[model samples]
Target: MAAAHRARHWSFGGVVLVVTAALVAAVLISFSGSVAPRADAAVAAQTWSDEFDGVAGHAPDGAKWTLETGGSGFGNHELQYYTNSTSNAALDGQGHLVITARKNTDAGLGCWYGQCQYTSARLNTARTFTQAYGRFEARIKIPRGQGIWPAFWMLGNDLGTVGWPNSGEIDIMENIGREPNTVHGTVHGPGYSGAGGLGAAYSLPGGRAFADDFHVFAIDWSPNSIVWSVDGTTYKTLTPADTGGKKWVFDHPFFIILNLAVGGDWPGSPDGSTAFPQTMTVDYVRASSSGSAPVARPIRGIGGMCVDVAGASSADRTPIQLHNCTGNAAQQWTVGNDGTVRAFGKCLDVAGGSTADGAIVQLYTCNGTNAQKWTYTAAHDFTNVGANKCLDAKGNSSADGTRLQTWRCTGAAGQKWTLG
Candidate 1:
């Protein structure tokens, strides 16, 4: 759960927390980098776990988890709005917590895109539990699709106060749909996170997709050490030295998080080949202190607010305006590989594909045209490729809902931008 440089894809993950740099508390915890006690040295006690034995169609135990509801993109430019509704997250009596992602353009949840095109759920143990040290594991059957992203991870409980990266994060498992045979485990801290996160991949042998059955994904932790394993097969381990001297921020308490995202930068947007109503069936999740348990980042624009999609809509020509940064999905923008700035699976476009000066800017379907192409230069100006104009907030106003337009580049404050 590291929300660092670039849009996190939930892998360091292609995932994230929505806190901002300006609000970060600068509180760093320096714990001794000594190794945690070895397994033979002490018998770890079982502290907490979820069997998903609740009545079918019911929500998971509220006392043991907190349902995070939002479509803020979670720093990943993800497409789905995580909701508290049982329709998105519920238990099956047979023993499983099913987090489902559905095609729901009518959900009306404000997403990074205008109307949320999809709906899912994200759950965490942030309020119910926090462990400093031990083991965390889960048995899961992941769903498959072009843009589905499923993960089991941990984040520092000090996230709110310290912000991300500094809060530390340990991803036990993260599987993007494209890599059906592989899953990743990673660590994100002060110097390493997002696409730069340090981690490794573990794959099922020979053309096997993990969705075939339930598999145990887990991490054994002790002090500076964290080991990742699949089905009890250890594949990777990490420590302070592995960070190239970056501060080891994982020494404190953390909480668990589980989520299924629909689309984002790393996983790309869902396409025709993708089927809707995908489900991540979690058989069980357990935690015990060997110890204890485990992360937002945002994009800021003119007026110290954020560049946001009006109405969180993805419909063609929706105004891309300035708004009080809510850190929601609407504000999560990604500088795509194709030179397009995207949000909610759509591109920042010059209205009507016009390249003329003073052209209105809006959200539109990515159509590989000059109107959608842009260059974010070293000077922080977003130069529209076709018109050679810069994106400027109207009237140099910082007011929420100020519309944006493309104007002749004049080195104006209204034309400057800072991407996360």
Candidate 2:
């Protein structure tokens, strides 16, 4: 059945909130380290990877991930008791990490609420691997049943200190068995956590269930944007503008997690129609970065000097000059998605709002004004939206003290700039 998944909320006493949200907020907190490979700034590279190839019926590599074991509803009143047993999670020797969920009729101390009806495993790269900006991907075939939930997600690296709703959460792939044809990708932060999270879903075409085959789920995360895709088809792209003026708090590192949950507020409970011993098979998991592009970093020019703000000031009309690249905030510029060059939260502007030839360029508080917008061309010309002129180095001088001004687009060497 093809349908849409809506965020659900629950009420207890006088408080109306989502059970799953409370579970995540009240529980799930950690911080650790891993010897993960670092990504380069230019060109894409595989930073961290796991093939899940090991002896049959054995646990996954201890150097990559560790099991997160518990049964306390996992913050969502889940019926599964998570254990470190190999029966619940292991490598199949055939190049796959297999997570199996079974009906736990065996009594004992396994259950979180009353008798445990199911058992599963949760694996996390908390202290083993974490990254800031990169592409996170995994290929897997999920289980199908009434109450099975399989997810590959991430939490901010500061989770152990700041806690949920503050640490941020990114759901790269989440599939409830009830919606076998659809998988969701969501991000949760301050004002947009829990039932208020912002996200989108991708469903298989032709009414096909995702459980019928292995599919690639991935997210390409950059400075303030994230793009989601399934099987190489991008379905959603989110940015700070999507948030309702809330803080963009995902500008830090995060860790990975993979788990098979049984019976949660979203998927409900396994009933008579459900089968036993369902499994989610993961062929591999990898994280990569297209390296750091110039747009996200400070821009440099001739003489190896950085585009600087005069005196490192935040005042309007501060001269935008070329200075020794110190890698300071004053010299750090961001080519915003809005087409403005920003430094210290201010936009690069033309002094006195002039359009005349030789008008000096300066830094001003960003106000979305035309003077603040610039369009960079492949030829390395910075065209000001307000003056409709090109940013040029006076007299074609590459000297450090040469002043910067607006001039006609002459395609001259002086007007050309290169991002470093």
Candidate 3:
């Protein structure tokens, strides 16, 4: 997310890394296939961690985080003046980092609007640590108010050189007080920054507000993809193919940030419904990277064509078929941790949610049902749950437009598949 409204459309993908263009291009091509399912044995090792294990009423570990002091609205027309003072940010003695936002009408305190009306704290790991690919997570309990905006996110490490969007931004978690039950996870890159970012929201189940309790927010970042999740439930995944063919810029390291802004253009200013001395509590932050990188490749079968969505459409219920692989987004798929083979933000589904043989397989909204889940093995056989049938290329046809369906697993060539 761009900090300033005037620079909202700025691209964060500018700083080219030391990696060769060919290598980067290869990374993009590799995602057209399947992502190796996140293996339990291959769990990424912890690389960085902060458990908020500090004395109550003391500052956070100075070696891990630095307070960002400013009253410049943070480029979002924010009402808060960030300070390093313990009153705004400090350990709660309960093993939590409490970031408090209070009414600050003190004339001595300056703000872009002349006198600061609110006070908060923004902390970052800018100069201390940065990581390229890993799983970053935090467990947080946010504050509630009409205009309170709390966020846990990351910015590209090259921000010093390329500035805003050209350096990229990944918002792992963002919640505005007005939508207490909902939170957002978004990625900003060239051509899709600011309000145009590609993202999705995950609301608390049973209509519960997030501020009522602590929830884990995280992102599993890999070479060319990122998966966003809450409380271990994966909700969204993004890759280069989802960028409308724009440059993929999240190849290098990025630093983490956490802040609680009183008011901003998006959240507006806290009103009568809002209260002062609001605090956002954080339990911990952790980062990890896997020793074995997972492989992603296209599932090709019946005449060597890839399993594809008909017409490259994003519309629901589009028939999935055997088509000529052209490295387009339509053919790109990922085997997710939740047992789904997905593309275009949808899942490969059994039409009518049926369990009968010959059930048509199409693209549908991912609802985590048995019909949407598939167990893909090294043999390339996709066995559907509930239906208890295998994904088959009808009539063993290799021609484009040959619709795929579920049939009794014959172990035939039509059901057999290969990764391209």
All candidates' TM-scores?
Answer: 0.62, 0.66, 0.79
Candidate 3 lDDT trough over 10 residues, lowest sum: 19-28
* Candidates sorted by lDDT, best first: 3, 1, 2
Q: In every candidate, how many clashes are there?
A: 34, 3, 10
RMSD of each: 21.1, 11.5, 5.6
Cα deviation of 88, candidate 2, in Å: 0.6
Residue 339 of model 3 has an lDDT of 65
lDDT for each residue of candidate 1 in 350-382, tens digit (9 for 90 to 100): 998776777899987666788988876777788
Query: In model 3, which regions exceed 4 Å deviation?
Result: 1-41, 44-49, 93-95, 105-108, 132-136, 198-208, 218-248, 286-295, 385-388
* Selected candidate, larger lDDT, 2 vs 3: 3
Model 1: per-residue Cα lDDT at residue 229 = 83
| Model 2: CA > 4 A from native | 1-42, 293-420
Encode model 3's per-residue lDDT on 1-420: one tens digit a residue.
Answer: 332222231112212221111111111111323434334323446777899987899998888887877787766778888888999999988889999999886679988889999999888776566787767999999999998999999887766567667778898998888888889888888787877787788999899999999999998776656878898777887877788888788888887889998787888788899988899999999876633223344678988899998987766799999888887777776565456777765779999888888899998766768999887666668888768899999998888889999999998899987655
Per-residue lDDT of candidate 2, residues 105-151 (tens digit): 67784655788888898887766676776679999999998888898
The pairs that clash in candidate 3 are 11-165, 11-166, 12-165, 12-166, 12-167, 12-168, 13-166, 33-297, 33-298, 34-297
Task: State model 3's lDDT.
Answer: 0.77
lDDT of each candidate versus the true structure: 0.76, 0.73, 0.77
Give candidate 2's error at residue 83 in angstroms.
0.9
